[model samples]
Each structure stands twice: as structure tokens, then as C-alpha cells.
Target: MVTGQAVQLDSRSAWQRMRHWAFAHAVDDFYQGLVPASIPFFVLERDYSYVAASGLALAATLGSSLPQPILGVIADRWRMLWLAPAGLAVAGIGAGLAGLAPSYPLVWLLLLLSGIGIAAFHPAAGRDARRAAGDSATAMSLFAAGGSVGFFLAPAVATPALVSLGVGATALFIPPAVLMGFVLWRFQQRQSRNPVAAKHSGGRDRWVPFLVLTAVAVVRSVISGGIATFLALYWINHLGASQALGGAALTVFFVGGVAGTLTGGRLADRLGVLRTIQIGSVAAIPALVALRATPDPWLGLLAAAAVGVAMNIPFAVLVKLGQDYLPNRPGTAAGVTLGLAVSAGGAFVPILGILADHSGPQAVLTALCFVPLAAVALGLLLADPSAE
Candidate 1:
């Protein structure tokens, strides 16, 4: 009876910690979503060319992507709990300053700085989330869903702010980050005072499966990033929808992602991670095709939602699978699967942009249809790490 009570207490504690971590994840990633959300405004307000706008994206990408592995290594070596709060503060401040910058270069620099904060936050937070969530895919899914929710909320928040008050309204966005940072700071302090060690199942790292998983992640990222980059344009240009409707399309897509992330966790818990990923990958191909093939704007919206659900169903599972594959270096696994591998897709966006420039948005989207088939093939190669 005492052991049962202790187990119940531990379960409750784990959920509380996971909730806090999930909130932090949402706050940190909200800044990332801000960049893409703000792009149209930048073009309209500043008359920036596509290449120039993409340059700003490149700055954010490089800042966010390049140093994550190194930071993950550092987190593993030193256990930098403070990075989580510090990262939120820096991300907020940088983004606030970016909105106020007088010149484009300064905007790029500020966004880059904001991206750095975002990069710093992830590995440490992911490591701690794993510690808190243990082997429960459902618990970890909550953390992943938080990020999707933040991304979904970005346009909803930024559109109103930009429309009413212009770019300076970004200042208003800072307070949440500051408040959340303080909350996380207090939580981390408590954690440091009464550290709970995470149990590890001793195992050798499976590089082959990890590499296959990375490939699958890269494909998923490409499809997701491409859709994010082009979806609004497709709605406005191809479907002849209003700009507001274009924004709505993006929001619907992200909402679907949030649903899919949460669903993936439950499915993984029941079906195992590998099978869940395979199902998602296979489903995504047909969904993407359907999205691209639909001519009616309203139908396309539904198709886009379907595509989002199908693509994101594997997201949380991939993160957990990576950690399971490399139990010895979960931080490194998190860094690669969560950070670097995900960012690699952004590199392909420029190519898609070039394709869009020459052919059209529809053509680029059509090309994206083939990516999920590749993901399906890769998914088939991945065995459940737990099984190993």
C-alpha cells in the first residue's frame, strides 16, 4: 500500500513537471513561429525582395540550427538547467528588438539573436522532459504538442498585433516570455534543490537505426517546412483567396499538427513507435497528393488539414525513438532529431522557393507530394528501438 501510494505520488509529480516543461516549450517556440508569421508584413512594410526576406530566414535558421548539437553536448556534460530560463528571456528580448530595428541588417541580427535563444533552450528542456516523462509517450507528446500550439498561435497573436499597432506591437509579446522565464527559473531552482535522478536502461547506441531515423526526420521536415513556406501563397495565389483566408489556412494546418502530435503519443503508447511512424508516413503520401490535387479553395483547406495531421503524427514518436536508440547520449539524440535534423529541411526551402520562382507555387507543392513516399520507405527501415 505504501509503495502504491508512492507510485501515485510520483506519477502526479511527473505530470506537474511535464506541464511546466510543455509551457516553457510553447513560450520558447512562439518566437520561432513569429519569424515566418511576420514575413509577409516585412515584405509589405519594408519592400524586401524574396531573396532578402529569405536571408532573414537564413539568419534565424543558422542561429537556431548550427549550435544546437554543441549546446546539447554542453548540456550533457554540465547539466545547464539555467539555460532554459535564460533562453526564454533572450528569445523574447531579441524578437522585441527585431521589431524596433531601423534597418534590415539590424532586423536580421536581432532575429538571429532570438533564434540563438531558441536553440539554447531545446536540448536542455528536452533532456529534462525525458527525465520527467520517463518512458511514457503520452506525457512526452504533451511537450511536443505545446510547440505545435505555440506555432499555431503565432499568426493568431501576430496578425492582430501587426494589424492594429504595426511592428512595434512585438514589444507586447515580450511580457509572456519574461513571465514564463521567471516561472521556469523558480521551477528549476526547486529542481536543483531536490534533484531526482532519471533511471536509464543501459544499452549501446544503435547508429544505423539512428541514421535511418534522421533521414525520416529530414524528409518530414522538408514537407512541413515547404508547406509552411508556401501554404499562404497557395491559398492567395492559386485559390484566389483573401490574405486573411491565407492566414486562416496556415492556422488550420498548425491546429491539425497539434492534434496529430497528441494523437501520435497515444498511438505510440498502444501500437509502438515504429508502427505509428510507418502509419503516419504511409498516410501522409496520399494526404499530400489529395491536398495538391484539390482545386476548390475550401476543399484544399480541408486537404491541408489532413496533410498536417498525417505529417505530424510521427513527430513526437521520432524524438522518443531517437532517445531510445541512443540511451547513452539522449541529449545528443535530442539535439539531432529535435534540432539539426529538423532544421535541415529549411535548407531545402530556398530550393523550393527557386522552383516557385520559375514554375509556380503549385509546381513546388506538387514536387512536395513525392517527399512523403520517401519518408514511407525510410520508415519501413526503422525498427522499434525498444525492441532492440
Candidate 2:
């Protein structure tokens, strides 16, 4: 009876920690989602060219991607609990300033700063999330699903604000970041005082397999980043849809991503991580092809949702699998899987934007159709790290 009670209490505690981390994850990623959602407005309001807009994305990508592995190393060596909360504050301030900046250079810098905050947040937060959730894929999924939920809400939140209040409305988004940051700061301080050692499934890092996984993840990222960057433009420019409808399309995709992330975690537990990734990779190709081929805007929206599910079905599984591949360097694994590999796709969006400049958004999206095939091939090369 006592053992049962203790187990129940631990479960409850674990859930509470997961909820806190998930909420922080949502708030941090909200800024990330905001970047893509806001790009259309930049084009419309500032008369920015597609290449210039993609440069903005590149700035964010560079800031987020370059320093993440270093930050992960720092987190591992120092156990920097404060980084999670501090990063939220920095991200919010940077995003808020981005809209208010007068020059393109200033705007680029602000977004870059925001990206750095995002980079800082993920490694430490993900490491803690793993600790909080232990080995439960479902619990880890719940935490990861928060980012998808944030991405889903970004259009819902930003579209209305941008439409009504203009870019300056980003200032209004800062309070929640401040509030969440403060709460998390206190939470981390308390946790540090009573730090619980994380259990490890001792193993050597498998660099070869991990590199293959990173490659697959990078391909997945390109598909995802390309879709987010161009989906609204496709709807508005190609389909002659309203701005609101374009936002709706992006929201639909993110909603499907939420569903996929949650389902992937459960499937990883039932099947295996490698199998789940392979299945998602295989499924994505058809969905993206259908999305590219559809003429009707409404059909395209449904296809977008399908693409989201197919692409994101391996989201949480990748993070878990990377950790398994490098149990000793879990922070480095999380940094690469969650940050560098994921953001690498965004770094290439400018080339896609160059394509969009000449070939139209459809052409750019059509190119994405073949990316998942590459990911599928890479997925086949990855053996289940746990099996070894």
C-alpha cells in the first residue's frame, strides 16, 4: 500500500513538472511560429522582396542554429537551470523589438536576438524534460507537443493582432513571456536547491547512426520550414484566398502536427522509434505530392493537414532516439536534434525563396515533394539504437 502511494505521488510530481516545462516550451516556440506568420505582413507592409524576407529567416536561423550545440555543452557542464527562464525573457524582448525597429538591419538584429533566446532555451529545457518524464515516450510527447500547439496558435494569435494593431502589436505579446519566465525562474531555482540526479541508460555515443538520424531530421526540417514559410503565400498569391484564410491554412497544418506528435510518441512505444520514423517518412512523400498537385484551395488545405501529419509523426521520437544514441551527451544530442538539425532547413529557405521569386510558390513546394524520399532513404539506414 505504501509503495503504491509513493508511486502515485511520483507520477503526479512528474506530471506537474512536465506541465511546467511544456508551458515554457509553448511560450518560447510561440516566437518561432510568429516569425513565419509575420513574414506575409512584412512583404505587404514594407514592400520587402522575397529574397529580403528569406534573409530575415536566415538571420533567425543563424542565430538559433549556430550556438545551440555550444549552449548544450554549457548546460551539460554547468547544469545551468537559469538559462531556460532567462532565454524566455530574451526571446520575448527581441521579438517585441523586431516589429518596432525602423530599419531592416535593426529588425534583422532583433529577430536574430530572439532566435538566440530560442537556441538557449531548448537544450536545457529538453534535458530537464527528459529527466522529468523519465522513460515514458507519452510524457515526453506531451512536452514536445507543446511546441506544435504554440506553432498552431501563432497564426491564431498573431494574425488578429497584426491585422488590427499592426506590427507594433508584438509588444502586447511580451507580457506572457515575462510572466512565464518569472514563474519558470522560480521553479528552476527551487529545483536546483533539491536537484534530483537523472538516471542514465549507460552507453557509448554512436556517431555514425546519429549522423544518419541528423540527416533525416534536416530533410524533415526543410519540408516543415518551407511549408511554414510559403504556405500562406501560396494560399494568398496562388489560390487568391483572403489573408485570414491563409492564416487558417497554416493553423490547419499545425493542428495536424499536434496530432501527429502525440500519436508518434504512442506509436514509438508500441512499435519502435526507427519504424515510426520510417513510416512517417514514407507517408510524407504522397501527402506533399498531393498538396503540390491540388488545384482547389480547399483541397490544398486538407492536403496541407495531411502533409503536417506525415512530416511531424516522428517529431518526439527523433529527440528520444537521439538521446538513446548518445546517453552520455544527452544535451549535445538534444541540441543537434532539436536545434541545429531542425533549423538547418530554415537556412536554405532563401534559396527556395529565390526559386519562389522566379518559379512561383507552387514550384518551391513541388520541390519539397522529393525531400521526404531522401529522408525515407536515410531512415532505412538507421538501425534502432536501443537494439544495439
Candidate 3:
């Protein structure tokens, strides 16, 4: 009876910690979303060209992507809980300051700094969050879903403010970062005082399967990045939809992503992680095909949502599986799956951009129809940790 009570109490405590990490993730990624959301305002207010605005995005992407793997190695070695809050604070301040910067270079640099903060936060947070999540894919899914929610909310939150107040309104987002950073700092301090042992199954690191999983993650990233980069254009240009309807389609896609992340985690609990990932990978091919073949923009909205859900159904599962495959290096695993490989997709977007330039957005979508087939092929090579 006493053991049962203690187990229940520990489970509740773990959940509470998981919630904190999830919230912090949302806040951190919100700054990421802010960059893209604010880009239009920069173009409008500063008369920046498409090239210059894209440069600003590239700045942030370079900062976030380059340092994460090294930082992940560092996190594994030192357990820098402070990085979570400090990074979060930097991300917010940098983004906030960008809106108020006088020169384009200054704004670009600030966005770069914001990206570094995001890079610094992930490996540390992933390491610690895994400690809290244990083997529950559902718990980790909540963390992943928080990011989706942040991205979904950014346009909604920043658009109205930027429309009314111009780019200066980005400064308004600074407070949440500051507040959340302090709260996370306190939360980490408390957890440190009562440190819990990390839960990792004793196993040898399986490099081959881990490599296969990374390939899968990269493919998934490319498909998702392609959709996100082009879906609105596809709606408006290809399907003859209004700008409002195009935006609505994009929103539906992101909302479906949030739902899919959560659903993946729950499915992982019931169906097992590798199986759930396989299902998602297989499902995405059909969803993307449907999106490509549909003639009506309204029908494409359903297909877009389906594509979003199917692609992300493996989102949280991939993070968890990467750790399981590399039990001795969870931080590094998370850094690669969450940061490096995901950013690799961004690199491909420029290629997609070139395609969009020549063949139209529908052609880009048609190309993406073939991308997830690679993910499915790679997924078949992934060994289930439990089965191993």
C-alpha cells in the first residue's frame, strides 16, 4: 500500500515537471515563429526586398542550427539546467530587440542571437524532459505539441499587434519570455534540490538504427518544411483561393500538427513507438498525394490537415525513439533529431523555392508527394528498441 502511494505521488510529480518543460518549449518556439510572422511587417515597414527578408530568416536559421549538436554533447557531459532559462531569456530579448533595431544588419544579428538561444535551450531541455517523461511517449508528445501550439499562435498573436503598431509590437512579446524564464529557473532549482534519477533502459547504442531514424527525421522535415513554405501559395495560386482562405488552410495544417503530435504520443503508448512511426510515415504518402490531386481549395484544406496530421504522427515518437536507440546519449540524440536534422529541412526549402520559382507551387507540392516515400523506406529499417 505504501509503495503504491509512493508510485502514484511520483507519477504526479513527473507530470507536473513535464508540464513545465512543455510550457517552456512553447515559449521558446514562439520566438522562432515570431521571426517568420514578423518578416512581412519588416518588408512592409522597412521596404526590405524579398532577398533581404529571407536573409533575416537565414540569420536566425544559421544561429539555431549550427551550435546545437555541440551543445547537446555539452549537455550530456555537464547537465546545464541553467541553459533552459538563460537560452529562453536570450531568445525572447533578441527577438524583442530586433523589432526595435535601427538597421537591417542589426535586426538580422538580433534574430541570429535569438536562434542561438533556441539552439542552446533544446538539448538541455530534451535531456531533462526525458528524465521527467521516462518511457511515456504521451508525455513527450505534450512537449512537442507545445511547440506546434506556439508556432500556430505566433501569427494570430503577432499579426494583430504588428498591424496596429507596426514592427515595434514585437517588443511586447519580450515580457512572456522574461516571465517564463524566471519561472523555469525557479522550477529547475526546485527540481535540482530533489534530483530524480534519469530512466533509461540498459542497452547498447545501436548506430545503424539511429542513423536510419535520422534519415527518417530529415525526410519528415523536408516534407513538412515544403508544405509549410508552399501551402499558402499553393492554395492561392494553384487552387484560386483568397489570401484569407490560404491563410486559413495554413492554420488548419498547424492545428492538425498539434493534434497529430499528441495523437502520436498516445498511439506510441498503445501501439508501440516504432509501429506508430511506421503508421505515420505510411499515412503521409497518401495524405500528400490527396493534397496534390485535389482541385478544390476547400477540399485541399481537408487534405492539408490530413497531411499535417500524418506527417507529424511520428514527431514526438522520433524524439523518444532516438533516445531509446542511443540510451547513453539522450542529449545528443535529441539535438540531432530535434535540431540538426530538422534544420536540414530548411536547407532543402531553398531548393523547393527554386522549384516553386520555375514549376509553380503545385509542382512543388507534386514533388513533395514523392518525399515521404523516402521516410517510409527508411522507417522500415528502424529497429524497435523494445523488440531488440
Candidate 4:
């Protein structure tokens, strides 16, 4: 039997809750890991051209992007209680089929399916998490931390699978998705049995914060995309760093993000959400600037960590902020935070890629620094829930 009425969790229980939450977040890694470990190898093994080989990842992102905002609205409106679970199931099934697909088009179709699966899960998962946390920063920290854990595990899970099953076959390893779905299904059933509480009013005026948050977050996302996409290349090309060291730098950044996110959430709860995001955004300015001028790999890695800490936390906080603004629209806020924020980064990819080509990654990153700085400015003016 499923249950609701807001899960009350202390630190220990919060961790336990997050374990389930993290399982849902891990869905990204399940497919993401395939890019390097399995998909590329499959291309080589199958003698597919570069264009054909790239379809899976490309199609997947596009597919996932399509439904998020719409689905988020649905989630906000109190429809599709089973959406998250069904989404995960779709992703898992898509992965399974992707492995078995014989042609490039088939792979594209499968990846699209997987993307839709991802799109389906995030809004509900995020909204549910926020509700469960009851505005506790620590609880939200636990919630956001699950994504990092998933990201951390992706390579570990997919790498071995790639070695054994080939890229396409590695999709079979995502067991957590199925289990999570079953559990979520149960929870939804319970949620249905008991009528939900009247949600907070999501109003037209909320657009002010929403737009500012989305705009600033997108800028941050661009900076992040620049770093994530090109940092290794930058290190190798400019600093003569080894590939391993570059990878380590990336890992350090992600670790920083995980730590920063948790810290940001806790701090936000205590200091106020806008204040926390403002501080994190300010903290990031120096980090991004330093990353470019520093010559040492160790220093670069340290800076990457700083970026991670600030980058990850702000969005999680923004989700919280969205919830604050749209008490009636947790699902919508969740969707914006998870789907739209990420998409913002994606939207910048082409332009940033062009900038990287014409100028260099440093220039792109330098340009990208303005995002969080803008966020800091916007955050300063933000009215809190108490103010409302």
C-alpha cells in the first residue's frame, strides 16, 4: 500500500528517502554512460559512419526535450500521477530496444524513446521530492544529491556493460528503473486514495521570478556546458595536461557540484533561498575567471570543484524558489528546474560551440561567466515567500 501526507525524515531517514530518489535521478546516467563506453564502440564494431553513430545521443536529447514543459504543466494540474513511473519504464524499455535495434534509424528511434522516458520522469520526481521535504533545505539537499550519485555511478555501470555486451546491449543493466517504477506506482496509488491538499496559488505574477531565474540559470548552464563539453580538450590543448588528468578535473567539478548542492540547500533553508543563491553565484565569478588564467592542473581542478559547488546548488535552489512562487504548481516548478534549466544549456550549445571554434574554450567560458553574475543581480531583488 502507498502512503503520503508528507514524509517526515531526519538525517538518517532523509538519506534513506534519497536512496529511492537517487534511483530516479540515475536514469540520466544510465543512458549518458552509453555515449562514451558503449555507443561509440558500437559504431566502430558495426562499421557505422560518424553521422549515423551520433544519432542515438542526439535523438535522445531531442526526444527528452520535447515533452518536459507540457508534461510539467500536466503534473502541476494534478494529472498523470503515474507519469514518473511510466516514464522510467519507457526509458528502460527504450534502452532494452535500443540495444537490439539493427539499423541507425532504429537506434535513433530507440534513443528518442529513451529521451521521452527521461522527459516523463523528471517533473513528477522533482515535485514529489520537494513535497516530501516540506521546505527543509537538508531534505532538498538529499534530493539533489541523488542525481550526482546517479551520475557518478553511470560510468561504472555502463563501462562494464560495454565491455561485456557491446554498447547497445548495456542498456539491460538499468535495474533501478523498474524497481523505482513499482515503488512509485504504489505511492501514487496511495496518493490517489487520499485526496491531495489544496496546492499554493500559482499566479501570473510569479512570472517575474520565473523569468529571471530561468534566464540566469540558462546563462549559468551555458558556462557549465562550455566547461563540461570542452574542459578536457582545453587542458590537453593548452596546458599539456594528460587525458586522465582532464578526466580527473571533470570528476572534481562534479564532486564539487554534489557537495555544493547539498550545502546550498541547507544554507538556503537557514539563510533564505535567494540569499543562498546570491552567495553561490558571487562565489562562482572568481572561480570561472580563475579557471582560465591558472596554469596548474591542480589549481584548475580546484577551480573546477568550486564551479561544481556553485553550479549545482543554484538550480536546486531555483527549483525551491519556483515552488515558493508557485505553491500550487510544484510540478511546474520542478519541470522548469530540471527540464528547462538543462535545456537552456542545450540551447547555448550551438552558439558556444561556434564561439569555441572561432575563439577558444577560454573565451567561451569567459563569456559564459556573465550568467551567474546576472543571477546574483537578479537574486538580490527577489522577494521571498514571507514577502509574498
Candidate 5:
């Protein structure tokens, strides 16, 4: 009975800690979302061309994506808990200041700084969140969903402010960063007083499987990026939907991602992570094919939602499994899976863009329909770390 009570208390404590981490993850990624959301306003207010606007985006992406693995290695070497809050503060400050900058170069620099901050936050947060999550895929899912929620909230939160106040409205988002940074810092202080020892799975690092998993993740990322980039266009052009309905379809797709993240975690806990990923990979093909086939705009919304859910079901699990696959280097695993793999997907988006140019937005969706097959193929090569 005493042991049972102790287990309950531990579980409750883990749940609470995961909640804080999830909230912090949301706050960190919110700034990332703010960049793309704010870009159109920059073009409008500053008379920037498409090329210039894309450069700003490239600056952010390069800054955020490139240093992550190195930072992950550093975090692993030093066990730096401070990076989480510090990075959060930096991300917020840089993004907030971008709107207030007078020149385009300054704006570009500020966003680059913001991206670096985001890069700094993920590996450390992933490492610590894994500690908090223990073996619960559901808890990890909550953390992953927080990021999705942050991203989903960005346009909603930023659009109103940008519309009313112009680009300078980005300054308004700065306070949340300061507030959340302090909250995360205080949480860290409390955690230090009662530190949870990192768990060692006593397993050897399996680079081949980890590489396979990374390939699967990159495939997932490509599909996700492709859909996000083209779904609204597909709805508006191919399906003959109103602009409003096109936006709604995108919203439904994102909301579905949040749901799928949570669902994947729960399913992982029951069905195992590897199996859940396989299911999601298989499921994405059919869902995307349905989206491609649907003629009715309203029905296509349903298909979009289904595609979102299916594509994202492996989202959190991939992160968790990456760590499991590299038990000796959790930070590196998270860095690559969370950072590099995601950014790598963007590199391929241009190919889809070319296809969209030649064929149509619908052709992009048609191409995405077959992309998940690569993930399925790679997934078959993965062995559950737990099984070993």
C-alpha cells in the first residue's frame, strides 16, 4: 500500500512537471510562429519584395536550424538547465524588437537572433522534458502539442495586433516571453532543490536505426510542410473555395494536429511507439489521397483534418523514439529530430513549389500523397529500443 501510494505521488509529480515544460515549449515556439506570421506585414509596411521577404525567412531558418545539434552536444556535455529559460527570453526579445527596427538589415538581424534563441531552447528543453516525462508517451505528447498550440495561436494572436498597430504590434508579444522566461526560471530553481536523476536505459546507441528514424522524420516533415504551404491554395484554386473557407481548412488541419499529437502519445503508451508510428505512416497515405480526390470543398476540409491527424500521430513519438534510440545522447537525438529533420523538410519544399508551378497546387497535394511511403519504408527498419 505504501509503495502504491508512492507510485501515485510520483506520477502526479511527473504530470505537474510536464505541464510546466509543455507551457514553456509553447512559449518558445510561439516566437517561431510569429516570424512567418509577421512576414506579410513586413512586406506590406516596408515595401519589401518577395525576394527580400524570403531572405528574412532564410536568416531565421539558418540561425535556428544550423546550430541546434552543436548546442545539443554542449547541453549534453554540461547539463545546462539555464538554456531553457535564457533561450526563451532571447527568442522573445529578438522577435519583439524586429518590428521596432528601422532598417531591413536590422530587422533581419533581430529575427536571426530570435531563431538562434529558439535553437538554444529545444535541445535542453527536450532533454529536461524527457526527464519529466519519464516513460509516459502521453506526457511527451502534451509537450509536443504545446508547441503545436503555440504555432496555431501565433497567427490568431499576431494578426489582430499587426492589423491594428501595423508591424510594430510585434512588440506586444515581447511581454509573454519575459513573463514565461521568469516562470520557467523559477520552475528550474524549484527543480534543482529536488532534482530528478536522469534515467539511463542501459542500452547501446543504435546509429543505424536512429538514422532510419531521422529519415522517417524528414519524410514526415516534408509532408507536413507541403500541406501547410499549399493546403489553402489548393482549397482556393482547385476546390473553388472562398478565401475564408480556405483559411478555415488550414485552421482545421492545425487543430487536428494538436488532437493527433495527444492521441499518438496515448496510443504509443498502449500500442508502443514503433507500432504507432507505422500506423500513422500508413494512415497518412490514404488520408492525403482522399484529400486529393475530394471535389467538395467542405468534404476536403474533412480530408485535410484527417491528413493532419495522420501525419502528426508520429510527431511526439518520433522525438521520444529518437531519444530512446540514442540513450547515451538524448540531447543529440532531440536536436536532430526536433530541429534538423524539421528544417530539412523545408529544403524540399522548393521542389514541391516547382511542381506547383508546373502542374498546380493540386499536383503538390498529389505528390504528398506518395511521400509517406518513404516514412513507412524507413519505419520498418526501426527496432523498438524497449524491445532490446
Candidate 6:
């Protein structure tokens, strides 16, 4: 007698969704953790110059990023449920192998391998979760925060491993990668009969908003890339801080991002994504500029935390905006927002590196401040949600 479909949210279903978010976060933590661990260490130990060393980061970014639009297109055409497990396995293996590579060329090849594998997971996982979340900003924020948590945890886990296990700790991360694949497969099978995914096969393009959003994303990433590569070095050189304190600042930066990711999403749910981005962009300017002026390590650290929060909160909300815009093509939007914008950070690391060498890190950072101002300018033109 019952012929139609049913859409209901139960406690069990909610728990499953949360688990998926954590799993996805773990995957990113593993992917991004490699940069702090392998990239710098590779350069220092090998005696490579900044420009040449940057090629490792560049390879990872170029490998991961340049493929997203194409990957999103493929996601639109085919649902590769199997890729979830396969991609994680490959990424894990590639990361582990990087430790063992006989030379720098092998490191690049391994990172590229890892990049391809990590690249496969984001778009698919994002699309699947958007269905479970039902286009809510809080849901997307929680999802994004999970990655921040993983990013924080990854270095904490790996750095100690470096002291005890030497480079082999890299390979040891493979078990978790394999576990991620299994979890995704289980979640997909359970949710297969759920009817809420109907929007996925329909239409999901908000051309104007997407273009505007991507613009801010690019500018934000340029600043973030500059920070990630040079923040620690600047602190050590100018602030008279030890290497440990500088590394701690990096932790503070990412921790603020974790806080921002969750808050940004929740605030967007209430205040709206456009509003959250405006506030975050306006708020970040002082934090970023202050780093150049402040000599006090404590003040700089506080500003760094503020910078992380102001800069990254938009990342979570922006992904949700992409989903809302392209309701049918959630995976594609997710890929472009999360994969491409985040990886764009890699492209600019070298540019800033060059500028820092010629003009000094302070000058490079000061010059980069205009990028956020641009984000603020372009963000004004973003269409209200009602348009979708």
C-alpha cells in the first residue's frame, strides 16, 4: 500500500552523519599533514634553495588543484562510490612512501601520487554529505571544522613519530587511510535507501555568486599561503623567538581556523554566508597587518590566531554557498570551493617566497594585504540567497 519515499531525520541518522564528517576530516588531516612534515624537512635536509624547494609544494598543489574542475565534471557524469576507499588508500600509501624516496625527484613523484589520491575524495564526500545535511550552513561548518581538527592532529601525531621512528612514521599512516575507505563504503550503503538525495541528480549552478565567491577564495588563499610558508621563519628571524615558539604559532593559526570553521558555518546559518564573509574579511585586515608591525611575540601570536579565524571561517561557509548555488551539482561546487581554493595556496607560496627574498618578508606580507580588501569589494556584489 505504501508506494512513495519517506524522508525523516532520526537520532541514528544524525549520528551517522557526524561520523562521516569526522572521517572526512581525518582524510584531510592526513593529506595536509604531509606539508608541515615532509616539505620543509625535505628542503632543509637536502640543502635545496627556496625556489627549488617550493616545487614540492607546487607539485602537490598543482597535482591536487588543477584537476578539480575536471574531477567535478566527472563527478557530475558518474558517481564513483568506490573512489572513496581507493583514493584514501592511494593517498596514504603515497604519503608513507615519500619518507622512503631515495631522492628529491622521488619525493615529488610520491607527493603527486598522494595528491591524485587525496584529490579523489573531497568532491564525492562533499556531495554525499550535502544530501544528509540538507543545505544547512551549520552542517557544512561542522564538516569543514572536522578537517581543521584533523590538520591540527596530523602534525601532532607525525612530528613525534619523526623523533622516534625516523622517516618510517610516514608509511605507518597507511592503516588509517585504509580505515577511511571502509567507513565511507559503510555510510554510503546505509544511506542508499534514503530519499533526500533527490536534488543531487537535478541542477546546481549559481554562476554569478560562484564566480564572485571563487574570487575572494583566491585572494584569501594568497594571503594564507604567504602566512603558512613564511610566518614561522619571520617570527624566528625578527621576533627573536625560538623555533619551538614559531612552530607553536603555526599551531595557533590552525587552531583559530578550527574555531572559525565551526563558528562561520553556524553564524552563516543565522546571519547569512555573505554577511559572515564580509565580517570575517573586514576583521582579518588588522590581524594580518599587525603581524608586520608588532615586535612582541605574544601580541603577534594573538594576531596570528585572529588572522587564522578571520581568514578561514569563510572557507566553511563558502563551500555551503557553493552547494546552495549548485544544488544539483553539490560535488562539483564542493570540489571547486574546497579542493581548488585550498590548493591555490600552493601556487602562491613560491611567488611570496620570491618576493620575500627580494623585498623582505614584511614587505611581501604588507603588499599582500590588498587581496582581502579585494575580497571585501567583490563580496558586496554577491547575490542574496533568495536568488537560488
What is every candidate's alpha-carbon RMSD to the true fold? Answer: 3.8, 3.9, 4.2, 4.6, 4.5, 3.7
Candidate 2 TM-score to native: 0.95
Off by over 4 Å in 2: 1-9, 196-198
Candidate 2 clashes between residue pairs 3 or more apart in a chain or in different chains: none
Candidate 3: residue 147 lDDT (0-100):
80
The best candidate by TM-score is 2
Alpha-carbon TM-score of each model against the true structure: 0.93, 0.95, 0.89, 0.79, 0.86, 0.89
What is the C-alpha local distance difference test score of each model? Answer: 0.81, 0.85, 0.81, 0.66, 0.80, 0.71
Query: What would you estimate as the lDDT of candidate 2?
Result: 0.85
Best by lDDT: 2
Model 1, CA-based lDDT: 0.81
lDDT of 5 at 60: 68
Off by over 4 Å in 4: 1-13, 16-18, 28-61, 92-111, 155-176, 186-205, 241-243, 359-363
Ten-residue stretch with the least lDDT total in model 3: 1-10
Using TM-score as the yardstick, the better of models 1 and 5 is 1
> Across residues 1-388, which tens digit of lDDT does each residue of candidate 5 receive?
0000000124465458588988998898888767766765786689875456556666666677888889878867776768889899999999999999999999989988998888888888887777677777898898888887776677557767877789998999999998999999898888879865553454677898899999998999888767765676677778888655665676677778888889999999999999999999999999999999999999887898898799889999999999888877777787888777865775666677678767877989888888998999888999867666
lDDT of 3 by residue, 1-388 (tens): 0000000124464357578988998999888777767775786689875456656767777777899889888878876778889999999999989999999989989999998998888888887777778777888898888888876677667767887898989999999999999999999999889876443455677888998898999899888766765676677778888755665677778778888999999999999998999999999988989999999999888998898799889999999999888887878888888777776676676677667667877888899988887888888888978666
Model 6 regions more than 4 Å off: 1-16, 163-168, 193-204, 359-363
- What residue runs in model 1 are displaced by over 4 Å at the alpha carbon? 1-9
What clash count goes with each model? 0, 0, 0, 3, 0, 2
What TM-score would you give candidate 3 relative to the actual structure?
Answer: 0.89
Over 4 Å off, model 5:
1-9, 39-57, 99-108, 163-168, 197-199, 233-247, 293-299, 354-361
With candidate 3 superimposed using the best TM-score fit, by how many Å does residue 240's alpha carbon deviate from the native?
5.0
lDDT of 2 by residue, 20-118 (tens): 888998898888888888888888889989888898888888888999889878766667778889888888888877888888999999999998998
